[model samples]
Target chain A: MLIQRLAIIGVGLIGGSLARALKRANAVGEVIGCGRNINNLQQAVELGVIDRYDTNPAQAVTEADMIVVAVPLGTIASVFAAIRDNLSAQAIITDVGSAKATVVADARQHLGNYLPRFVPGHPIAGTEKSGVAASFAELFEQHRVILTPLQETDPQAVATVSTMWTQTGAEVIEMSVTHHDEVLAATSHLPHILAYSLVDTLAKMAERTEIFRFAAGGFRDFTRIASSDPQMWHDICLANQQAILQILDSFKTDLTQLITAIQQNDSQYIATVFSRAKSARDKFCG
Target chain B: MLIQRLAIIGVGLIGGSLARALKRANAVGEVIGCGRNINNLQQAVELGVIDRYDTNPAQAVTEADMIVVAVPLGTIASVFAAIRDNLSAQAIITDVGSAKATVVADARQHLGNYLPRFVPGHPIAGTEKSGVAASFAELFEQHRVILTPLQETDPQAVATVSTMWTQTGAEVIEMSVTHHDEVLAATSHLPHILAYSLVDTLAKMAERTEIFRFAAGGFRDFTRIASSDPQMWHDICLANQQAILQILDSFKTDLTQLITAIQQNDSQYIATVFSRAKSARDKFCG
Candidate 1:
């Protein structure tokens, strides 16, 4: 077995899916799920996602060879604090958060001498759905899992985590925590924020009902991300504040230039911007 | 037959699709496609989207009972002017443009006495693909078609256009030209501008390839519209400048509040905005 005992400290989609994948692959001898929601943990156990369940983080990590924290960004610090003293000295710790820099900083504060074992990770995959019921073994197939290891991180720990993710069908790549946070802030976090803002602005209009009724396919596709979990996004925004703000500033400047072009009836300028955006999007995402 | 001879200017997706739908329903005796590009018009005829093709709008509308102008918003005035003197007195004219107020104003300037026979329309349907090859008979099935009739428009002409759209399987609704422009600015124009701006900004980053590679499903869905036709969107932005600028200003205010909330780490404020957006999007576009 890759790990004798695997502890996942949040029996939601990410954590539950990982547990299910590991169990199916026979990568772990035992799987333990820990979370604040007893009902969700119980459901994970009943669904065979975990061998057992625990509400206490310290108890859960007592003998775990690997510990994965899959909670919201706001709770990462507390999760680290709870398991700091009880975690086995040899256990490799990791997390599946959207933002990595904040998680690495929190780990530095809580893990102390055990910091080298903590690797901040983010899996670039998910649906809008959440909870254990939404978990599936194939969710990470062909997806990327980025690991942001600290300067003092042990190579063996990183290798073990990387192997475990590979077993679950994910390609793992290593990068600095700051760079991870910056890239994700631009690609994921800022899009969610913009979607939310657009939806909120349109919903507040006097002609909202009719406006939505006539919204074309383009509008529907563009605002689909606005339906994601609010509390989760709220925590992400705070955790990746600096990176998010920088991208937001850049986006605002581009938007303002577009506004000027439109106001001046500068068709050539407007066409240039849209053409570049279309070619780039097609090249990268088509 | 609803129309004895139907002339369609600009046989691209919208014009070609309308002709195909009309032909499928046997609603028109003969359909004629007109455009500056002879090759596209020839392609439309070969696809059986039109019975014949012509490069001159005036010649195409000589004996036409109904004329549909489906060119880009930037060319509406020129198209109207081209056919104005040759249009039969009994012929009814209409256009499928994204912005209505500008088209209506242009019609007043070009159509003169023919204004009473003109109706403005927008079919809320399309794929990212364009041109004759992308046109299909069922493109407008279950889609909405909004008609903004001028004050002096003949009720009989409005009824005729509504019946034609209904025959094409589209639900037709009526509103003022100004109201149509304002509503579409909020729902469509602003979103397109935002998508183009975000994609352009991200594509210019030093780590752009990696950023695009790791973008999750949400980012892909949120920026799909950025791959739309640049010249078409440029025309739309300029055609509806006033309404677009107004909505953009409002969106800027909402975005500024969100930025401030993120900077202050005001989780409650962020949650409220995101929750409202999620619920609103679910209710409207779910």
Candidate 2:
């Protein structure tokens, strides 16, 4: 099962960057891009990210041995519906969506038995920028890519998808789709939501303009994820709302404790939290 | 007058780093260090961060032409009290404390009319690591050093302190002490608190060990500030409780809005927040 021909749906930052990286590695023989925007398709072709471009999802799916759906989470089902009948029997399709359970469920419903070959993955790598112009070869290097393979997934098929991602320089870890959503909701999804909300709240304040001017390097870095594509993040928040809400509740509890410590001038409690956090970050992230 | 002799109180990260940078720039004729910890004083001398170490605050202040208080916020008043009558009348004094208003207030009450020459300053630069070992010459270069000077502050004294910080490659900005705290609460203090709290929350999660194992670059960068000194952060949170609590309340409200949007599947609201945040970050932080 050599992935000689690859079709990338929604050739934006993640998808476009993957195509660019694959092309740079020359891992695949032919790459075709499919997108709703003709200008984007043309620009992707001009950028040499794809060898060809097509507006029709059906036509693109018919020729490729592998397909990557890189659209927002809300559109995952429609995307699958559009390509369901045209996908080759041997085609190994995957996605770069942030949420996993809902995407995997959609695949199971739409593609039926072929869902086994549908590897739902998320590469935990991105920049503040978006679109084909922002794509780069090293986008996924040394990044974690969690693959949520359904119980019905074939071992051989999972291995094939894992190999494809490995070639793109991502370290793939397999996890239950539900677990993936829960973990991401804690680590990635909730963080983005918090950053976005913080930005909005500060922007509405009386000193909004000066607020940004005073945002130190830490604030800038903490809020960097808020710069992600709005539509994409919006789709993720809605799609993974339950998990996100649960994580938010936990975060609020933690924040409330912190606030209480500060208000009560509990220096000891504050020190304990700071020490625990520092040690955890150093041991794991250092 | 030439700074033929200098005294630095509480030789930790800021004081030690300033000593290193001053040495590199060939600005000081002699450096004397004072601290409660005899081992830290010895380490500062061993690391060449000071020319001499003194456990007696009176002896350290009496022999120096200038003094820099680098101790914790709560300890600043005691540092002044220990050296109040022992100081040389010509000796210009400054502090590197994070909160300016409290220190300024302390200096006013403790030193009386001598307070006009006591400049309250903060170097807006640091790393998570601290102590004498973490001191480096280039730490303050290209960074901002804010001075909170009152109406009673002498112009010559301000100029001298400004010149010293400038020589170390920092751009000095003058502002009111209260304004400094307010701006910094949004910029530095709040961010550190949030980062530490976020890390603590994640660390306490059941599967955190595993989640951290897969923590990517973004997570590492986002939580980097959490690894700062626990005692330092504890003192800061207690000293700057009012502003921090106000900002935290605002942050919570914004977070609630985002959670609501996600729950309702309001893609438009989510995208708007993300886009606005992205634009704000790019405009201010780019």
Candidate 3:
């Protein structure tokens, strides 16, 4: 087994799925799920996603060989602080957070001596759904897991976390924390903000019900991310604010150019932009 | 059979799918596929999406009892002009265009004596894939077909068109052309523009390859519409320019508020906007 005892803080979709995937792969000896929600932790155990459950992070990580912090961005520091004094020296800590810079900063601030063993990570896979009930063993299969290990972090710790993610059927790629935040801001965070904003704008209008009633498959797919958990998104927005704002500004400039082009009936401009975008998306996106 | 001979202009996804659906329901006699591409039309006939093929709209519509003009918005006027003189007196003409105002105007300009028999329609359905190869008999099943009949248009024409759509298992909803365009701008056209712009913006960035490499399922779904036909969206943007620009402006205002909220770390404001959007999307969207 790659892991003798694994402590998974925040037994939600990502954490639970990781545990389940590891168990299915026979790479983990024991998985102990810990969270604020005792019922969810218990459910994770009952579902066999974890070997046991703990309501306290300190108690959960007491004898664990590794800890997976899968909590929302807002709670990263607190979860880190609570588990700091209890972690074993060899215990490699990694996260499944969407944002990396703040998460690594949280480790530095609250992980104490264990900061060297902390590897900030993000699994580039999830549904709009949440909680242990939404967790699946194949969630990370064929998906990418990005690791943004700090310079002070132990190389062995990074390798352990990468191996663990690989056992869960994810392809692990390492990059700097700044690059992770910026790229995710452009690809994930910005589109989410646009979707939420678009849905809210339409819903607040005079003909909202009618507008939504007649919405086609395109609109449904476009706004699907708007159905994601708001509190989680709230934390993400705050954690990744600068990068998101930068990309948002870039998008705004582009959108303004489109507005002017359409107003001026510049079909060639619209076509070129759209054609380039289509070719790029077709080439890059699955 | 409700139609003695059904003529499908621009026998691509929507048109070919409609023909397939009607044939599956046994609602039409002879199906004639017409488009500029002789190869695609020949393939449609070979695939049984249509009984025969014609390269000219005028020749294709001769003696046809029902006609579906499924060409792009930019070519609606030309297609209507081409088929106007060849339409039988009893023939009912309808379009499957996205924007109804320009389509109604196109009919009025070109259909002449056939104006009363013209019905403006949009079967709120599609996939990113196009052509007869992508068409299916169930493309419109359980979907909505919106018809915007003009004042000078015959109710019998609308009824017949509605029944034909019903035969394809679509629920027909009728509204004024103005309301349809405005609502569609918010729900459909504006989202397409944003997706195209977002994808184009990211693809233009210095780290485009790495950014796309780390993009998750959320990004994939959010930008799925970006992979749609560029020429179709180009036509849509120009045809529905005014309404699209208006909703886009509203969306921009809301987006600005979000930017301000994120920059200022106004957590409550961001939470409120995101929460409302989630709730509305959960309620109104499928």
Candidate 4:
């Protein structure tokens, strides 16, 4: 087995799905789930997503050969602190937080001597749904998992975590923690913020009901991400503040240019921007 | 039959789909397709989307009891001018433009006495795909069709046009020209512009290919409208400038507030906005 005992803190969609996938591949001997919500942890255990469940992170990771911190960004530091004292020296630590730089920083702050075993990671996979019941073994298949290992991280720890993700049918790639933050800020976080802002703006309009009633498939698709988890996104925005703000500024500048083009009746300018975006999207998304 | 001979100018997705739907419902005796693109009109004829094809709008609308102008917003006036002299006194004219106020203004400028017969409309239905070949009979199924009839417009013309859309399985609703423009500006035009702007901004990033590669399902859904027709969107942005600008300002304000909340580490504020948006979207979109 890849791991003698695998402990996952926060047993939600990401943690539960990883446990299930590892169990399915027989990559881990025993899976233990740790979370604040007893109901969720209980459900994970009852659903066979975890071999056992515990509320105390320190106790859960005491004998674990691997520990995965799969919690919200705001709770990362506390989770790291809770598991630090009991973590095995040989245990490889990783996480599935959306923002890697902050997670790495939180690990450095709380993990102390165990920092070398901590490999920051983010698996670029999930649905809008949450909780253990919504997770499955195939959740990570054909998906990309980015590992942003810190300077003090052990190479073997990174490799072990990478191999575990690979066993789940994920393509694992490594990058700097800062680079991961910047890339995700532009690709994921900014889009979610825009979706929420747009939906909120429209929902406040006087003719909101009719506006929504007549919204076509395009509008539905464009705002689908607005339906995502609020607290999770709230933590993400705070954790990756600088990178997200920079990207948001860039987007605002671009939007202002479009607004000016429309105001000036510059059809050519509008068409150029739209065509360029379409070509790029077609090339990449196709 | 609802009409003896119906002429459809600019027989692309909207026009061709309407023809097909009307034909399927046996609501029109004959359909004549008119457009600048000879290839698309010929294809529409071959596909039996229209009974006949003509390049000249004037010739196409001769003796036609109904004329549906479905060209790009920028070309609406010219199309109306082309068909005005040939239109029978008893014929009713309508358009499927995205912006209603501008369409109404254009009809007034070009249609002369026929302005009373012109009913401005926007059928909130379309795929990213365009042209006659992309048209389908069920494109308007369960879709909303907004008609913004002019004050001088005949009630009989409005009723007839509304009935025709209803026959094609669309729910017909009427609003004033300005109200339609404002609602559409908030719901449709603004979302499209945002999608195009976001896609354009990200495509110009240095790590663009990698960014697109890691973009999750949420990003794909949020930018799906960015793949829409460039020319069509350009015209829409121009035609609906005032209303769009108003809504854009509101969205910018909300976005600024969100950015401030994030920059200030106001997690509660961010969560409130996101939760509100999620609740609104789920209630409306579900």
Q: Least accurate stretch of 10 residues (summed lDDT) in model 1 chain B? A: B37-46
Question: Which lDDT tens digits does candidate 3 get at residues B18-77?
Answer: 999999999999999999988998899999999998898899999999999998999999
Cα error, residue A17 of model 4, in Å, equals: 1.9
The residue-by-residue lDDT of candidate 2 on B104-218, one tens digit each, is 8789889876788898999988888888888898888988899988898889889989988987898899988887888788878877887888888889999998878766666
The list of candidate 3 runs beyond 4 A from truth reads none
Q: Which of 2 and 3 is ahead in lDDT? A: 3
Better of 3 and 4 by lDDT: 3
Q: What is candidate 1's lDDT per residue for B148-240, written digit by digit as tens?
A: 987799999999999999999999999988888899999889998999999999998988998998887888888898988998998898888
Q: What share of the true interface contacts does each candidate keep?
A: 0.92, 0.70, 0.93, 0.86
CA RMSD of all predictions: 1.6, 1.9, 1.3, 1.5
Ranking by TM-score: 3, 4, 1, 2
Candidate 2 TM-score, true structure as reference: 0.95
Which is the leading candidate under DockQ?
3
Off by over 4 Å in 1: none
Encode model 2's per-residue lDDT on A62-109: one tens digit a residue.
Answer: 868889999878888988989988988888889999998789778978
RMSD of 4: 1.5
Tens digit of per-residue lDDT, candidate 4, span A207-242: 788778777888888888888889899999988899
lDDT of 1 by residue, A1-286 (tens): 8999999999898998998888888898999999988888888889999989889999999889999999999999999999999988789999999998888889989988889998888889988778999999998888999998888999999999999999999999999888888999899999999999999998888878988988888888899888888988999999999999999999988888888888888888899899999998999989
Sort the predicted structures by DockQ, highest score first: 3, 1, 4, 2
- Chain B vs. true chain B: TM-score for each candidate? 0.98, 0.96, 0.99, 0.98
Query: Which of the two, 1 or 3, has more DockQ?
Result: 3
TM of each candidate vs. truth: 0.97, 0.95, 0.98, 0.97
